[model samples]
Target: MSATTYDRLVEIVTKLHDAPEDRISPDVTFAQLDVDSLTMVEISMRIERELDVHIDDNELEADLTLDATTKLIDAKLAA
Candidate 1:
């Protein structure tokens, strides 16, 4: 995934979850980030609104890492 997309995801996650930027790595999972279902929804909405990409809810999971989400977003953007 592009650094831009990864950076943006980091930004969104940190902002929404009140997580420290340093704690947010590509390998970090949503559960590790303490992101709950409600926050996940907010993240999804923010990604769509900010990135103009649509990611289905089924595509997001607590076990998903930042890298996986970035790759998913990249794939959607590519498509």
Candidate 2:
């Protein structure tokens, strides 16, 4: 796993979530944090801009966890 990638994601998520970094974990999902669909879209946009990756809404909605999303990013990068 890329710690830098994970850390960057956590940074972005924490900022968007308006919560502390410590509150986020690899296993925690966005729904668990009370992040609505709209915010999830915003987060997806931010992630694409910041990470220079293409993540569709469906893929994001499918797995809103740090671990799973990071894996998705890795898979995208691999592709």
Candidate 3:
């Protein structure tokens, strides 16, 4: 998954949380990582800036899992 959306998402979360990517499997939720509201906002912005995708801020209100975010990013890219 190198250079893929999934890998990017995992790398982002792992970087923020200082956790190993493998410890942050696809199904792991942001809540599990103690992600705060502010951090979510930061993440949202980073994803948009880094991926050049206009992800709605509301996306963070839904499932904030790496896998889910990857899917969202991929779908947006496909569109």
Candidate 4:
């Protein structure tokens, strides 16, 4: 995955969840970060708004890591 994409995802997730930047990493999953369903929706919306990529709510998985999420976003952007 692109470092730029990973960095932006980390920024969005950290800000939305009020999580410390240091606590988030490419391998860390949303579940590990204590991100709930509501927060997942919020994250999806924020990603669409900020990244100009639409990620359906169903597409967001709590078990997905930041690296995986970045790859998804990259695929969407490519499509």
Which prediction has the highest lDDT against the true structure?
A: 1
TM-score of each: 0.92, 0.85, 0.83, 0.90
Whole-structure CA lDDT of model 4:
0.91
- Candidate 1 lDDT over 1-79, as tens digits, reads 5559999998888888988777888899999988999999999999999998998898889999999999999999999
Q: What is the C-alpha RMSD of each candidate to the true structure, in Å?
A: 2.3, 2.5, 2.0, 2.5
> In terms of TM-score, how similar is model 4 to the real structure?
0.90
Candidate 2: tens digits of C-alpha lDDT, residues 1-79: 6557778888778777776656688898887777788878888898899988998878887346888888888788788
1-79 in candidate 3: lDDT tens per residue?
3498887777666665666555678888888777887878877887888889877777775357778888889999999
Error of 1 at 37 (Å): 0.5
Q: After superposition, how far is residue 2 of candidate 4 from its true place, in Å?
A: 11
Clashes of 4: 0
lDDT of each: 0.91, 0.80, 0.76, 0.91
Writing each residue's lDDT as its tens digit, candidate 4 over 1-79 gives 6559888998889888977767788899999999999999999999999999999877899999999999999999999
**Candidate order (TM-score):** 1, 4, 2, 3
Best by TM-score: 1
- Winner on TM-score between 1 and 2 is 1
Candidate 1 residue spans exceeding 4 A from truth: 1-3
Give Cα distance to truth, residue 24, candidate 3, Å: 0.6
